[model samples]
Target: MLAQLLCKTGLNSLNLNTKLFVSLMLLLAMATQSTAVVAQTDRLTLIYVSEMTEMDSEEKGSYPKLASLLEHYRQINNHLVFISGGGGLAPSAMSSLDMGAHIIDLLNAIEPVAMVAGKREFSFGEDVLSLRTYEAAFPVISSNIFDPITQENLDGVNDSLLMTVDGVTIGLLALLPPIAHQEYNLQRVEIQSPVDALKQRANELRSAGADRVILTYSCCYRDYLNYFDELDQLLHDGLIDLALGKDEHLLLADHQLDQMHPAHIWITQGDEVAVVELTLEKDAPTFLMNWQTDSMNAYPADAQVQMLVDGYIQRLESLLNEVIADVKTEFATFQTDVRTAENPFGNLLADVIKAHADAEIALVNGGYIRGERQYQIGEQLARRDIMRELPFRDQVVLVEVSGEQLLLALENGFSQIEEIKGRFPHVSGMQVEYDRRKPVGKRVVSVRVAEQPLLPQQTYRLATRQFIATGGDGFDMFGDLEPLRYAGQSNRLIADILIDAIQQSQQIAPLNEGRLIDLSSP
Candidate 1:
């Protein structure tokens, strides 16, 4: 047809060389247009959530609702990938009893492609996490964590994973913060630098034929602001295609950092879910990415997941409903009260831990108390109540520290008082007087242990949570000091100790007792 049309249009009148050249150019143009029309585009949607624990609250994001939302996406796009950004494994009433097994069972139903190993995953210790990993249907990954004994990633945990979604090979890596070692029961494992691990694994994945790489990281403790610079550099350098972050419970719009690299997404709260859509064109090495988030409340609960959640809640309620003790006065567990100043409940907790350890003094971080509610006078405190308040199963450990070191620890506690940090000391056998108007390290005006003036040279037996004794919450003054053990020194869970104390006493009346005095108060 082209030859006949060309002859009629007077192409035959041209010389053979010119006619051939024009014909070749037309053929080339036709091939280019055909390739453009035949190009294939694939879409991958990633559904992300983190820091989830309980499924009991309708006000918050529940696993059932999450399941429904996932199904909605799967219906629209078969290339949907669900990612658990870690957390949600422990520190709840049920998790305290079952060591997060219920959460694992619930997640199995959701069937995430990968679950990041956040610090909370080690809340019950490496052994329990190893067991949980065995139960999980999906891959549990942490790129920077390793077991020295195995000389590899922790048992059952992968350093990275590669999956093909709609013909696109996606590489995944999860990173934990450095503080996991200091804050949790991760003594059995070693954490490498997350940034270095990310770079190494990303290159390896690319070399292994991955078309795109995604990272999910929980960096720092509660503050992720400091990690953005390094993440932006990685994005600019083209090592990673997308980055997902956890721990900071704020949506992208609420973040204080206005200018963020386009590839990063921070999904903190369970109530919110983030979706990252990637469009890959056939024969193209790179892809276009888009991100959006929605509330889990927008979706209805999936019937199967709801049934599973209900069964677990019933089992948990049976164990938690028994009345343990009666309170003579209302005890407050408000974050501001417990973290910024002394409260009656904090006093009771410190006293119980001190008595259990048989130590002269006991110090508990305000952050350890998480009930965040006030127990009214005459309210019967149940086993559930205690667990709700102290859910981490933190053990009481005995240590001997000089009065000078004690002073420094107290200073560290008060250092972040302005931020209402968790390090604030809830004391058992000591009275602290401080003027916040003074410099941070020098805030302590005076300290008395057992009603006697503290002697910097004198060493006192201290009873505190293993977390603090091991340098958590900036209590580095106790660095590398081994726990002291003597006759009858039981390193029992702090919650159990408190429960026993309440059960033994039958009735309790605890007061502030002026343990923490702030001269800055008007």
Candidate 2:
């Protein structure tokens, strides 16, 4: 009967399905024969989803297909459990109407055991997530993040989880990304080094007598192989049975998986999922990874998930559909545009910050303009569109700094050009010329503000987001500014300022205007 359920609902990946079918088929055959039944061990399955951004839903991602798919598996296998890799919680502005609260509801329906906290979760701040975590059916874990304000681990976040399924003591641990501390400064939590935190957490899990351990590694694209030797050692010592991660860049192809014998099973996000079947026998637990990382558009939407999604759409219909601004020319914000060079949206954002703060210059990180979609020339920019584009809910403020500090800030912005990170500055009321070929920390060839060379001794009013004002993304020089305060109060959102500016102007056109030039780039 269990075999019938599995056969009817196929595994997403052929390779995993083969392993699952081969192993389970034998059990099914034995069951049908009514032979002297050998003591059969149960199959424990782990279902996972990760990195769910605003666009990752039936309407934008795979269909309601995921919710019902897991529900079926959960029904058939009492040992089956769902878990998340912790990225689905932020840029709340872009997610379903309640700003990703709908996503929480969706994740809850599947009933995750634990979810790792990722960098995106920090974007929403702890207060908001603290309330929303109550809405979740599962525990949120962040081994590396501790609440600086409360001097404890972040509220509503667990370091790890432990459970027993079919007599197998399973452990789940979550590792927040290591770079969180440098990129985000929360009023609530502080991020410890992930490596140290993970080690401590892993030891605790082993001490707790977990037979199998699963790790939620949100690091994803980093060169973890170099340091994964530790995890490899854990696997060899039998401390860790499996490493569950979601890194699209590091996924192993089906044909190549066996050769690697990887301790980790990395799932690529999107509409895809990983169904891991753990065969529990007297000896060490064995694993079969079913990685289905493609063609989610073809997957049919599950009815239950569809119902939830429909309800959210209905609730947000009025607000989401509202046309906030009508575009005249295209205001595209491709990743390439935001990180490497100036684009329409980036340029407009810089202009808005300068205008709103009534400051001489403004430099906002290109990374702050979030999203993967590009807007068209004539399309109506809805409230949803704006929210998705600027999701962090950051405030705009003014700081007075010397021209010398401004130059250093510009230098810091260009220092990480190779990585194409958020530190890349989009400027207004100023022009920058840099040679990428030059060494890091010395890339700025020339910078001029207000049509004149910056006088080192002179102080000027600067405008930027609170993230930058707080020394996030490595612009620490800005932190030295005096008389720093919100241009209005601390209440003005950068997104609102931009939206209102576009509505007032009735047109959106921002030129590159040679604000930043890289001679090394063609």
Candidate 3:
């Protein structure tokens, strides 16, 4: 009736003889309301979700209550469940039975609708993946993954989901973290181009009667910002409706869509603010971090969510406790010097390759060891422990290169000695001397294999992870070497050998054999 009255008066003022009537126009109000009711009743409803990782015991910190997400959902009296970033065992748990249970406890309290995959999801392997996927009430979406042999998208997971709220339809699409592909080999399905794939998906949703589409992807902050701008621009132009980014350990920033568009951007974690938009035309999402009277915190954890959390935690504890090792002491620091002319750590690793492959000589770059940390006394270790240090999981291979190719390896390693910070080779079965003052490529004065001068024509066998062998880190010269063998070994990443050696011997010492140090010409 109020809308009718306003509309009648609004129309009356436009006529010349109406005298801009006010109170007398009440009768026409009811008539106007009757017509207005037939106009439009459809609207889009959205509930944004994020993936939150559980904190370890040493790092036990609670996030803002899940009631915040729920309370926001309750306002519309519609269903929109916020979920974790696949709350399973944290990578640090290493199969701890309690890991999943703890996360489940925390998440049940929040009662989210679904979860997206995180890199840590792969920490427990396929069995755990199947277990967690089944246990979740909501769907687990990862579009890019495909089976290695079957070459089909993994079964039991949806590519996306369609939901309706208050007559408003929303489409949710998921993306896997790139690191899951690079570091963990979780690329069971290859990812199609983000922009291309998403555009096609949005069209499909639109054809299926979806009013708006949103993406809930797992990636880093910078990547989120990048795709957000791309999607927001398209959305502002009516290409899509909205894009919600996740995967930062904490909420970082808020980006409002276009000033004139009905789109908004947000990120949230435990204790982070929930962006509130009262109207679509509002200039920005009102940031709300405090538990003021406007927010939700009074509600308790959802019972079903709590049950799932309990089961996951129990399973995790039993599995992780399965002893992988029993060590006497824990090392505080283990220092490794792999750059010197005679690198103890690198030489030991190279010799392993040389012996294992029956190669004449071997060279492995120091960068492969990752940060190459300093180890302390009594540091017990396991297989997963070493794998962490060498996260790339690069395949090990043997290459045969001519003395010129050998010289190239020497030059590359030598160039690193003077030009780069840590590119020097930790070599085995060879000795090298070089001049630091001379320009790179001219720096290596001499190179020898067991006291014999290197012959540019004679081929020498080399063993190294395919990463550097195929020119990772500017070693492109190695991409075209003659193949002697491909050992295909992850049994002992170089870091494992070093850690195990230090753990058992209880002695941590590394010497620089003066591989590339400046020698004042005698």
Candidate 4:
């Protein structure tokens, strides 16, 4: 009768009174299987997490909050997957070193299955990425990035990862943006297009008897849109199940399956970043969780996780204390965008480039310029903070190029801003415009120097960064320019100029200008 009742209660097959108590517990779990279900011996569960930069104090108090959330999840389930996107590489003593360590420590305690590289993972260069991976104590995978010469993968320890969870075999492939390769001009490493590589690997995984194949990619929306149709077709044909994307700054709401396509798709914005979540079961249902601003209340900080973050903060504070306080100023912070009306920092940088190169016109990449918040007077500025804003130590170069070269650089600088929104060139003495409605190459409609029409054959002494001079961000035409001179550490020059300007006036007030042509309406 007891056996009969137990069986009716869904515990029948287990001999609870016998030595198989553990086995009976597993059986009961399978029956309930609703809230936080541990996978049965035959089932596997993966919790995906991503876009965790800016969770620290530099942005807000998000660092501790994220750690706490991870810890809470770790206490219940030991399987977590992390894919961090780029953009948190701003210079700061706080997260520069300790951010990844703290993130890894908490996740390791939870026992994550694997962590794929997001583009931001490489935002600080290869060395910083290596250090973070070493400290992670988990698998770091970057399959697409390889050594330029050796062609060996630069993923620290492991390249690709396969894990058998809950009776399901899963294969993971990672990819990065091609721009990263172009930025470093990596000789050995080549970043394959995600679409091309995935199809081949998906076949390989399927032939190897894998039940599911997932792609964790860090790329912009344009890349995703370019390949979305093809990927959706793959899912419809049952070739690949899930594709997660990072790199976009905005958060997308969780979306449902495309009615036209058989498969489901979603993109998540992390806490100050974003990630995509995919559940392999029931045909790969996907969802997007915004970790940056939303989704905070649901997952409060776990005490244990907060403790780990505190330790990292302490280490960072110690390092920051040693940085010589350069200048004392009232509360003021500079925005990174430089294409618009010049901020104090931007104007100062322009002055530095002009001084260093003795050129009439100066052009700087909007990539520099940090300090999103206001700095108070008596605040001792540190070199580290400045460096954070200007992470790339690109030198300033003087190029005596024709007006045509200058015009090309301006157009390329403003290339993806309309589509991607933030790639613009800030200048000191020139203005340019292009028709947005018109095709690429023909977009530039007008060009002027200090209100004077530009002369195509006339050579101008222009000061610009080394990266742009060599066609770093699609300014390939500039590489043909006659070399006038090389000014190293243009960032340093700008920083020094800023310090002096602040000291002389003891006041720094900058404003935004609608200088660069905005073809948004057009």
Candidate 5:
């Protein structure tokens, strides 16, 4: 509604004071807490978002519609404490601009005091993150991340951040699990063991007179289950007020949190926002932290936040909105489809890379096709569409592989079928027949590439994402294969290539034939 009003009032005609007021209203709307919480004079509200991954309420109607929620909270309470759950910088969010700088500017608009560093934040170099953090109003903190070469703390990351609200001191820290840098083929920082790092730094925060401590971890998975007992100990000992973790898209709400502590919270990129209410009292036993997650639909879009987001979108729209082609049909991909069998979308993406590199064969990990939503037929494909769909920014790599190595790669791709890993290859120039019933290494029943049966002695030129080329998702056979194209160029983002290819073709309706087949006992 605010956006509509501004649109009619001639957005450009709004004076600077009016714009600022609208922006503040938007912030208040976004910060608004769920009404389910028990209101009291001594309570402080902390709005926590994790694995945001560049997702804003404006981008999509995901949970905790931030702009309007902020506006809601701003009007209700003056002492709301907003903190980020990290994973703020993602390729989809950064495709058109400097993501770190842009997100920092955006986060500043709502005035969050601090945020933890999620693992994906390391996708860009530390120098880039450092520059952005320097520009951010809030602290980008991590207790365990550090520079690999100098062994010093990263330039812009801190071990902890302290925020004082209403005479109450709150301390927050971020912990990251060891990452797959070898598999991803990029390195700028190293991480320490999460358990030891959290224990030590948390003690320091409390000793320094922090009345409450909040723990944030960027590794958003149940993979951190091993540390549950340790977290229980921290809560029982009154060392931390809250703990935040994101396991995929799962929303671990207050009920699931009862086992860990009275105040445990989990949030994802979209779908929900965790609002933790802290009740500060004279006695430690009486102090309370209550968490609730409300959907983004719970509030309306604040005019202020809508305008700020509009500015960012409008700045990029002219170039990113250009139509590349019209899709004749819906070529969609879902988690089950991409991870298990070949889908039309995967076939199209793999074909795009194969055509771009002019390689005889090409494949991509299902993990990189992150358009969780499906596209409609007859929709005009644009740069923005590709950006949202294939956001990983992984480059294409052409490599030489023998028949035996190719077979091994295919076997590796299907080896983790039970786990549904992204390594499952979607091929462009090959037909693979595999059996999940067979042993892991012997899963490939038949492999034909470039219209020929596999030959042991012949080496084939294969094009794939650098993630696979560098053995990501456990396709290590590629590490032995030599680079056949763009040997030293690892930054040619496949998204850009896909856009260009779509423009040149003017239309795409990739075949969904027998490229990948699964023959196994159900």
Candidate 6:
């Protein structure tokens, strides 16, 4: 309108120079107006849920509840992206039987834009992970993990993902801990430095016209401090817009929200969901971010999703409902009890594995017992109960180590007592006394095996999870030592071994024989 008005008001007698100046002014004004229109903010709603495998439990975070919450957002928001932070595929009762195929089926109903490959994705090893990934309807991504033999991303997994929502381009990248290969029993995948992977990928995303870059990492609690520092630097330098973390449940439980880094968010338990709102500036590489966490209880279960969940549950119950044993006493499997002190369930687990391997001693990490609840006296233990308690499907293996190496392994277990790490050992055929007041490596006061004092020079047969025998949970002292009884030698998993033991005994009693003595306890 302004241009037309200027043209109509122009006098025929105006000089050429004057007319040219007026024309230039009109063009400048038009350009400014177009710029203003282009600079409008684009809103994006990102719903992030991590450790989705935890949804299998009878908690508020079940798949039906999450599906309802997501559907609600989908209805209200035009631009929404659902992200599964991975770690949901394994370590659950159902996952133990199906190798996470059921998890993939459930997640397919609530299709995520992308799912990050968490450490637990490798729970059953590379071939199983490949099968799970193949069954996924969404992209499974991990930028820092690759197949060493193929020099490519793992089968059916992507290195990264580019998604466009409401005209805003988003770059999604995921990182598995560098030690994931060792910790998660990864045989075919190799991990690169996450920092290097992020730096390289973020730049590529930006160059490829990404408006925002989000990183998802599955790192254990102890690695969070280091990852946070690196993430803060990336955010400060504008390499990544945001970071979502998984496998930091303990850190999330211990720390306050105010203590968290501004650009980093840790996914809490399955019962909660983190919603991130982003305001992307048009033609600019900046965005405004707001995060809010909501409980799954806020939404009613989607009827369709509920049906699907019920179907799976019904199928699982048929196979798992058989009674395995009758309990004569309360069996404790709470995390605080199993991870920090001698637990009756842990004692039984160690004894079962030891007996199965016919080894002189057995060591079970507190983390291995995951029931997280007590079984009261007179309660019937079912196959389902055993599966939930020992969901990892890890094999029991026997290994021979010098008594000195055994002591070092014991020290490693006691070293992380303050953190209540899973490395804390539950023992059979041995009594260990440790003083927390002493330095980490020097905390072991004494260790006796078979009622005999530990001899540093003598070799002892140790039965443990294949995970520990291969040096998981910081038990590097056991690394590279060939197992006396290879895990593959037995077709039975630890859960299977325990189930047989319970069946043979018919009735079980809680046994805490003071095998793990904390001298520092008052």
RMSD of every prediction = 13.5, 8.1, 14.5, 9.9, 8.4, 12.4
Best by TM-score: 6
In the range 100-212, model 3's lDDT, one tens digit per residue, is: 43554454445444455555465444345646554444455554454555554454445555654334455666556543543333424455556666777667767776655
Candidate 6 lDDT, tens digit per residue, 474-505?
78788888978443367678898889889998
Task: Name every residue pair that clashes in candidate 6.
Answer: 53-88
TM-score sort, best first? 6, 1, 2, 5, 4, 3
Q: For model 2, what is the alpha-carbon lDDT of residue 458?
A: 97
Q: Estimate every model's Cα lDDT from 0 to 1.
A: 0.77, 0.68, 0.49, 0.53, 0.68, 0.76
Q: After superposition, how far is residue 186 of candidate 6 from its true place, in Å?
A: 2.9
- C-alpha-based local distance difference test score of model 6: 0.76
With a 3 Å backbone cut-off (N, CA, C), the pairs that clash in candidate 1 are 52-88
Candidate 3 residue 252 Cα shift, in angstroms, is 9.7
Which segments of model 2 are wrong by more than 4 Å? 1-41, 55-63, 92-99, 148-151, 223-233, 249-261, 285-298, 480-490
lDDT, candidate 1, 1-522, per-residue tens: 011011111111121234334544563454345434433336767888888877756544699989988988866665567888888787788887788998888987886777888888988788888888777766678888878888777877778877654456778888888767866636679988878878888888888777788888653325434465786689778899888875443424534446666777765555888888887554555554678887888888889999998888788787688888888986788788888988998999999888887899989899898887887888888888888888886788889999999999999999888767788899989999998889989999999998899999999999899888988878889877889886666656788888888898897678889999999998
Model 2 gets an lDDT of 0.68
**Tens-digit lDDT string for candidate 4 (258-331):** 24243233344444322233343534443222222234344566566567667766765654444445444343
Model 4 alpha-carbon miss at residue 54, Å: 2.6
lDDT of 5 by residue, 345-417 (tens): 8898898788777788887878777766676777887777778778665678889888888888888788777
Worst-scoring 10-residue span by lDDT in model 5: 2-11
- Cα displacement (Å) at residue 457, model 3: 8.1
Residue 130 error, candidate 1, Å: 2.0
The TM-score values for the models, in the order shown, are 0.85, 0.84, 0.52, 0.71, 0.81, 0.86
For candidate 6, the per-residue lDDT at 31 reads: 38
lDDT tens readout by residue for model 2, 149-268: 666576666667766554566677777765666676565577776557767777787777666667777646453443455655665666566777766554444554554335567666
